[model samples]
Target: MSSILHVELAAEPAAAGRSRRVTGRWLTSLCGAEQPCATAQDLVLAVNEAVSNSAEHAYRGDPSGVVVLHGTADGPRVELEVSDHGRWRDPPADNGFRGRGLDMIEAVAEDVRVERGPRGTTVTFCGTLGQCSGTCEP
Candidate 1:
């Protein structure tokens, strides 16, 4: 059976750190030995990056902003959603800084989706988990 975890927290640097730790623990508990060492590491890195994006770009760095995380861990498939209650935009083609983090997330995730508008931004990532394979190859 699949499960889902949904949560919201302050979009601050400190909160970002906390979210990373929490996600690591949660993934470990949920996947156990079925999740390989390398897979765990990648998940951790991806979670941290997502949280960092929320803190840095969410609300454009507003002190009281909040980011929401929701996802599921079921057997070999783990999915996550990181959302910010802030503004979002497609960076100008001429702009160099453009969507690097979102791009990075897409590269790491086997499947990804993004929703952007005046209300907020949400980035979702998912990959497979294997008992004998901890790393994703693609």
Candidate 2:
């Protein structure tokens, strides 16, 4: 019995807590208390990166954007998405911005998906939670 928790937040600098809390709630629903810790941390980091991108790149730090996140606990998988209505600029040529946030997200997550365009960008990731026994917890 898997379930989904969907959250929508304003793409402001302050939404960080809201973002984290959403991830936490979803993990609690999906993984309970113990083993989900690491999985939940991954979710937190990924969402943080995505939201930072939304706030800094999407609206270009001016705000006036919305970040919509959805977390799903499916069989052996936990999925997440961060979406906003801000355009995506090309990353610096020399790979200079540091940290490789996107790469880290992809590395830790089992699957990653990105949708980008002139209007906005949406980043999504999914990975196994807990024992990952081909069946998710809820």
Candidate 3:
């Protein structure tokens, strides 16, 4: 059996928090009975980072952009995809702070994929319940 959820929000800082909460609630209802709390938390964190990146970089200085979040739970794994219909920009050089969202997403997710094109950018990540023990290879 598989379950899926989707949400669309304005590309803004506040939307990141709202996305996180919605994703967390969906994951809890879908996996909380069997998946570990830590696993769920990790997945939620990854989604949060993805959304934050979109809000911060994808549509920089523009709040009119849109972000779409899709989540699916199948068997023992959960997959999330966050997409923005805006041009992509390279992460800025670290001057002391910032530029850690991608790193943090990779750390928490068992699998991560990023794609950019003229139309938009999409980040997809997945995590397994009680399965991963070490760093997940690309």
Candidate 4:
């Protein structure tokens, strides 16, 4: 069986934390066990980064932007997509202590896709739910 989690929140600073908490709970329930899936923490971390990115950069100075978080788990695979309707922002040239979110997401997820257009941006992260197989390296 497959399970889905969907949440839409204003693109604000606190949205990241809210998304993380909701995702954690959804993962725990989806696992159907006392503890969440083995990779749940990593998944949540990656998701937080995505939501944070949207909350920080998507709307620019506008506060009316909306960010959507959608997740699905089926069998051994889990996929999440974080999207925003606001215009995309180019990363600053001198990102001294930031701009590592995409790299971090790529590290944890087996597959990552980012789409940007007039409509907005959507970042998708996909990975296995349990222990890594031959495809994943420690």
User: Is 2 or 4 the stronger prediction by TM-score?
Assistant: 4
The digit string of per-residue lDDT tens for model 4 on 48-116 reads 999999999989868899999999988667799999988877888998999999989998776899999
**Model 1 stretches with alpha carbons more than 4 Å out:** 34-36, 92-99, 132-138
By summed lDDT, which 10 consecutive residues of candidate 1 come out lowest? 129-138
lDDT of 1 by residue, 30-131 (tens): 655444356666666677778787777767757889888777877768898888878775566775765576667766676778888788888888876565
The C-alpha TM-scores of every prediction are 0.79, 0.82, 0.85, 0.87
Q: TM-score for model 3? A: 0.85
Best by lDDT: 4
lDDT of 3: 0.80
Question: What RMSD value applies to candidate 2?
Answer: 3.6
Q: Sorted by lDDT, highest first, which candidate order results?
A: 4, 3, 2, 1
Tens-digit per-residue lDDT, 55-135, candidate 2:
666777665678888777776577888888887888887876674878888877767888998768989898677643333
Instruction: Itemize residue pairs with steric clashes in candidate 2.
Output: 76-136
Considering only N, C-alpha and C atoms within 3 Å, which residue pairs clash in candidate 4?
Answer: none
Q: Count clashing residue pairs per candidate.
A: 2, 1, 0, 0
Each prediction's RMSD over C-alphas, in Å, is 3.3, 3.6, 4.3, 3.7
lDDT of each: 0.71, 0.74, 0.80, 0.82
